[model samples]
Target: MNTLTDDIDAHALEAAWGELDRVARLRPIHDEDSYDHAVALMNRVLDVMGDNEQHPLAGLLELLATLVGNYEQKHYSLI
Candidate 1:
């Protein structure tokens, strides 16, 4: 079983970096257009992963959701 303190090997770290780079290439949501794109990406991720907390893409989905939420909160008035 894996624990939080377990160190990730170099190969795993490299793979993680690769994934981050690929995702970063998708440009984060900064304006209306990017916001729409981000929403689409988030929807795709959700469709694949659903609400499974143990899914590999869960962290990425959560990060995208947070980015979308932050952009919306800043650009639109909340009720």
Candidate 2:
């Protein structure tokens, strides 16, 4: 099966660097839709985990996840 963490090469990762950068810099995802999009993107990274080949995209995903998680924690923290 195609995985995000499989067969990843520097060149392939470099190719995706721009998109990863954009995602990393994404902000103001205040609505559920935007949050959902981030989640979806994260899930997509997980689903493709084996094929990412150490793709920097994964790092972007992690950063985005952190951002989303931080927002959620502040806005929807449990009492």
Candidate 3:
């Protein structure tokens, strides 16, 4: 398990960041269309990443999912 005290692997960190940038552009969910796009992106990531907590992309997926949920809660009534 990785911890804060663990020594950072610079090359691996750089590759991870690159993957994150490629997968998630990290755009603001400002409108319905943008929110929809975010939802789709999140779904794609979830399909690949699943609920695996140890996966490197898990954090990015969670962040996108949270953004989607927040936008939906604020803009639309939940059924």
lDDT of each: 0.83, 0.74, 0.83
Clashes of 3: 0
Per-residue C-alpha lDDT of model 3 across residues 1-79, encoded as one tens digit per residue = 8797588888899898788679666677999888978988888888887768788878778789889888888889667
Better model by TM-score: candidate 1 vs candidate 2: 1
Give the per-residue lDDT of model 1 (tens digit) for 32-53.
8889988998898899897687
lDDT of 2 at 58: 79
* Stretches of candidate 1 exceeding 4 Å from the true structure: 1-24
Q: Which stretches of candidate 3 lie over 4 Å from their true place?
A: 1-23
For residues 1-79, what per-residue lDDT tens digits would candidate 2 score against the true structure? 9887677887877867767567643555788887888787777777767676588677766777797898799789899
lDDT of 3 at 31: 94
Candidate 2 similarity to native, TM-score:
0.55
What's the C-alpha lDDT at position 75 in model 1? 86
**Model 2 segments beyond 4 Å from truth?**
1-26, 51-53
Error of 2 at 10 (Å): 22
Q: State model 3's lDDT.
A: 0.83
Model 3 Cα shift for residue 13 (angstroms): 11
